[model samples]
Target: MAKHDLDPNYLDPNYEPVVNRSGNHPFHEVLAARLQRRSVMKGTVGAALASLMGVTLVGCSSDDDDDAADSADSSGGSASAATELGFKAIPVSTANQVVVPEGYSAVPFLPWGTPITGAYPEFQADASNTGAEQEQQVGMHHDGLHFFPIDQKAGGNSSTEGLLVMNHEYINQDALHPNGATAAADNLGVRPEDEVRKEIAAHGVSVVHIKQDSNGTWDLVFGSPFNRRITGGTEMDIRGPLRGYCKLVTRFSPSATETRGTLNNCSMGPTPWGTYLAAEENWHGYFANSEVNPPREQTRHGVGSSSRYDWELAAGGADAYVRFDVTPGLGDPDTDYRNEANTYGYMVEIDPFTPEAKPQKRTALGRFGHEGVIFAPAVEGKPVVCYSGDDSRFEYIYKFVSSQPYSAATAGGYLLDEGTLYVARFNDDGTGEWLSLSLEDDDFAAKVTAANGSMVGDINFTGFADQADVLLNTRLAADIAGATPMDRPEWGAVDPNTGEVYFTLTNNSQRTEGQTDAANPIAENRTGHIIRWSEAGGDHAATSFDWDIFVFAGEQGTETVVDGEAVVTLDDDNIFNSPDGLWFDYNGRLWIQTDGSDAAPYQNNMMLAANPVTREIKRFFVGPVGCEVTGVVTTPDVKTMFVNIQHPEVDWPFGTEGDHPRDATVIVTRDDGGVVGA
Candidate 1:
């Protein structure tokens, strides 16, 4: 569907401020003036502000050259016909049915119990899947994924052969066994290590190879050479600023030389260099506390009794169980893994090309519940910029500006090291400032030291040990630097052709009533909007930038009448709430995905596609009952698209009469058999 035509009344350029009865503050006044100016802009203010900031905003010129190079590398073939470019919606209901658009067919490749790595018994649907057994089997709840062609010479589109790297964000606890997870009480003080180990093993990432059959169906290559699993218990090396910092040390690895496993592998990104950047989200719920009080260091990190998870109370619990506990264990900080919490929350980079390579947790990018990382258009001799969001209430949006300029010779090399992290401060007046969270700044350190007293330093003191330390504890640094708190930032993408950055501000219910402000203008922002910003001078590394609300969420007609009279508003144009998953396809078409928990008015989550440059948007597909549409990736040809459906019907009562589990990945292709969004 096309966007609603803009009305003339809303286009008035000379409109003045309509004073509200509410009392004014200096912050509000500045914000009001900014919003007034933004209402008149046709495009982002980032480009114009770039000149003032003395940074260059990379634009269409660079992208044009990249596109030319990509074209030259491809075999000369006419673009796929429109009929071959269409997308078919698949209905994967809880009844275990996989539906596809007419004329297209689908086959289930790997189910929950399929064997991948060891000599394990074939999955028994009716039997309990042990933690150790689950480790040997395929992970549950497949989420974000990418299909990489094994041979680049064969073209990077979806082929009959290649390696598929998919993230199993989490497992469905209810579906873990024949019945459900065995409670500590039920187990009678005899917690099975295998059970806990199985759960941990299921929590990371899975890599497999698949081959398209002559009949056009896809199936897993059972024992493919590249197939591997990175679980929570696997050994991984520590990299970045905090690599060998005292806080990251533990009894298991006294020098902090290495750590065990990666968990909560959510949405991911693949660098040009072929490494995978997996984001860690919701990792706070894994630890627990003992009956007795723990050490001072644990409390220092906010790992107190109330902060612990239920799993900690289980039998056989100790340092292994307490490691998840943020509570400082007694004795030296290095004595236990209480400090281990500091290690997680950073982006873990894994070289899928080399399975033996230790995954590096790039600390240059500040840490938090990183939703995903999207790279800006790479420019020769210019620093590469990557955008990320802290996916939590009142968190901040961040960007990493690499210290080294882009060199084709090292395009896929180790450039993740040595970069500056900047958090966004979006102003109401369409302008924004990227505040640096640098260790060199004394003021920044003082603020952090005050909030987190464990940090030892003064206003004039640079307390950070190094860059890795800053990245590992990014949230602390961001708070000290006073970054703007956004609603809930998720996936972000940069328009290849226009160089505009689009990020999702997922809904925040706590923002109701008292939290209303100029930048966050609405109370109870249930339907989150998409925010776009251009770097000053078109450079991703600029300190200052300009931004604006590209879209606002709400019911289609609910916003048409503000104060009982019809007024032109953004809510009328492509109004959809809680924009979550986002990506830019090779064709430069912007795809917007939604994840709404509120069900009454909105039946289920959905996905939409838009042309940001033209403001043209359409509702492309809607998901089945109770699911979040996440982790979207498109082939280089833009002909095939893969979207993930995560935790469908998550709230259904456990063991209830009507409960049903929904989780799987479905392929969407056109009914006319054409490329998607052609």
Candidate 2:
């Protein structure tokens, strides 16, 4: 969530190290196989080889084509993919403002610190709001979001009004405090108690009632009952395998059934039964462990000697702030906070419709740096299926299949609490299998034994003690299962029209030529690629699937190297890098967003619309300088879309150049009042 400088040192909160020492098969060879398969499909090796080098299979046309293709139903539900992308591709820009198509409007909404509840404290541009006051305002750095209709029972599609619920991934410390943090610039001194509290309060999710007027203007409903803030200090119930595990036993929750706060939430998903699943990402940097050889759970996750922010070093050393220190003391496990970090890194289920309900951390989903989670369409009598990617270099992608059949009337978070978490093994031959991580399964245990006998790395292939241990150290379990190590797998989305799943492998510059595979074909992949897969027999719970590369991000006229040679390149209209946010509208338009470097032809982060059937992509919108364009959704009517711009370098949307830039939501709509992107 922090500025991704891609540093290897653990000092930066956002630096995700290559902790995977699994020595599994590299994804590079898989790329070669895919090339061979395409060649055979073309019926001529030479012609297909030549065409592959050009890599124009997925073309980006600059022309403003308005061909009516396919579209979904009016309710944003599954329908024929017959709608064509009607907008002209916008050019890349570095200016400190949002740019959209000719017939669209981009308006800023819900900037950080806006009051939504309690005493309705006003936002202070100078950053002088107290921690208590911040609790009543929207949290900072908005990420994944959804618009829940005001009246849920009435088909849940009210475009006029709804509750906008979104995650505040993290805080911009420099702009959060009156004069930056109370600690030294390098963060060396003890932090003031209130400043630490405010920082914690700014790191969760915000739920506020929002509405649209007849003039097409939108604003928050002041003091609505649905308005609420879930911060790092809010108490949450723990469910699934790790609920009462000893490793989760901390002083605050001695019973190990509850924990305080959710941190570093990234992308999100909605349950079929109408709930929000906020994913916790990059949370390992929040805790510090002083032990010379910390437990595998802490060390494996890259929990270092010092935390990103020294909340544990707060002046008063209250229990609330001291819990950030995971260093074990002379006291017993229940007497300290060593296991506090174990309570995080799960998909937290929040019921926005019920403001009084406590959020539940669904542990059935494996614990890792979850970029996001997306569920497959729920079938009345079939088990629920979902996919999540661990957003770390060379980490594995995971899937959770619920044990109970999905029933529309009875579905809830309880189904998520009982499931089997599996890691993906993307074979070089294009076929992939799901490796079970469930400790109760005999086959998985045998695989662990085999890996232990042959393993040769810093990681000890010790067998898992129970399901709780496996879920707590999910990466380790994945390692033993021989899951394919990908190139920093991030957000994933499932196509509503076809059950295919797509994921953005946000760039991994560390990958070498030798590590490149069919799935991750590029060497030193500065510009990432998108990969999609179809489940066997159209079964979401199937153990196998077929995958292929969808698109590779690069600049026009520049050589994009793969396996030590130039093979793929992009065109002017859709040149981009580091694809992060991905989504699919009901009409099946695949929306792709970038969080790339502000270098060369691509000046700022942008979003693009892709026609999945035709393999055509076109630029849609561009954000201000140094801002990551993410979190997108459309009203059921498809007339309006909401996207978030986070941590802009320049002051924007209401601030002068000298003032601090604030993260806010951008509202996009059509001037002619037609469906957006069509």
Candidate 3:
């Protein structure tokens, strides 16, 4: 475990290594067909595609304050009404500060290392906090988050107070310590036990009770019962199909019903039953396999020979830290840590209001670098449905439909325990289908058996023996089923009004011209795009759907629909790349966040608002240099908005720009007290 032996790319949180070898139809080919079809259409490409997708297009306008106001046909009102952008658009900034539209205020709150429980230790600027202290403080690198109203049980949606829950994606190693992590004096391979513990403590979810004062300032309510930190060492329950599976047996959780901690948690989603869903993205990089050949579960998921942090090599050989190494021992699987890695890579459901509840890993959703899960609007007597995207190059998007119907009074995480997971297959035509990956799917079984001869190095590929196996090896199952390979699918949002599901395909630089398709049309796509699809008959449980390219990042995917027809709608007012985080406010205004490299014109990562009907985008806010603008949510009233600034390169929140940068949440509100995107 020498330093040089470490996987260099593993340390890069944004580096999604290309793991999908499915050879499935790439999205660019679909895009090519879509463009060709548009060429033959008489109307505008936007109008034609909108018609196919059951959407009505309006004249595109970049002005922030368009007076036309009507209800939208997708979910709520007439087809002509589109949500209007009320604020004046702002210019992109390279400054080490936040820039919002005029008449808006941005206040920083709940930064990393801010104590919320335990002894309530104060944050030291030198990063000298101990491992135990970090467990009681806010975690680092905030990502996906949500604000649950405080008085929901009383049937009240209070905007002044609530529980703010967020995911700490990963750590900024260089800034985590006074002088960074210390290696062993004798061997640079081993990390200090205390440092490793602190690092682990900083990688999970944080639930804090926050209150907004009359003056509009927000502060954390220290020592509240609802404030808790579920870190990498926290005990979590294993739920759903793989709960008692043999492959999950480890020295810690021998029953295979529980395991320790959640890692690499990225974006988050809310369950219909008032619970938070934390996505495990890039958790595979934290483990290493020394065996000559690893199981398909690890190999297919990109568990490399070397770990990202060398946690397995922590000093003193404590099982808590050493379990990161999945190398098989001389004893049976239960006697070693080979199955430890299998416990991760699933959507973990946590009840932020119930402090005593254990986080449940919902395995029925299928596991493969989940970016986040967005549930479709629940129907009283219909199946509960949700969608997730595997956040890696060439990976597939997935949909999970619960076997049981939904009921408000009895709904719980158990609803996620039994479901049929389907992988998306985008056809060259405008239509698409959800290919089932369940045990009852004969097509999946046949494909697995047919491809058995060509498959290599998968010791655990037993031809879809059971539902547990299919879920644990979800990427392989989707690959065999001929699912479409997307361009680094990341965060997703479900429009409450239209029932349209939107996903951000964060840039895929690995795509080639030969692999391009309609969903992913760009070759060497540096700036990614957003894709949206509407379920058939407006029913989320429907197997058939229609999809269209919502918008191309940096205007790259906008091909010529007809002669002299300009379909590229992005202008200087709202041009962004790497659209990573997406959310639709209750008003149906789509908020787009960027994690881009901040190329010219796009000075730094920012958040923009887009009108779904008009496809008009306007830059709303710009973040500091070297920071990713992610994890956005608003209070139930939509008057206040919270956005996370992760991994700032220089010192932030304190308004300095030299070093020891801290990730924090910024609160945005209109000075006149109006809706966020009114």
Compared with the true structure, what per-residue lDDT tens digits does model 2 show for residues 1-678? 211222224333347767787787656555665453322211110011112322324333444433212111211233233546788888999888999999999999998888999999998878889999999898988889988878864566888899889999987777787776665234445778899899999989999899999898889987689999999999999999899999999999889999999999889988888899999999988898988988888777888887777788887779999999999878987899999999989999999989999999999898899988999999999999999999988888999999999998888999999989999998766789998998678889888778764542456656677888989999988888888888788889998777889999887788776764443434577777788888999999999988877776767653333334433234678788889999998678899999877887788999999876555578999999888898999887888899998888768887733445788999999999988998
Q: Scored by CA lDDT, what does every candidate get? A: 0.59, 0.80, 0.82
TM-score of each: 0.79, 0.91, 0.93
lDDT of model number 2: 0.80
Least well predicted 10-residue stretch by lDDT in candidate 2: 41-50
Name the TM-score of candidate 3. Answer: 0.93
Ranking by lDDT: 3, 2, 1
Models, CA RMSD each: 10.7, 5.0, 3.7
- For candidate 1, the lDDT comes to 0.59
Off by over 4 Å in 3: 1-8, 37-61, 64-82, 184-188, 456-461, 513-522, 555-564, 655-658
Residue 574 shift from truth in candidate 1, angstroms = 5.3
Residue 285 local lDDT, model 3? 87
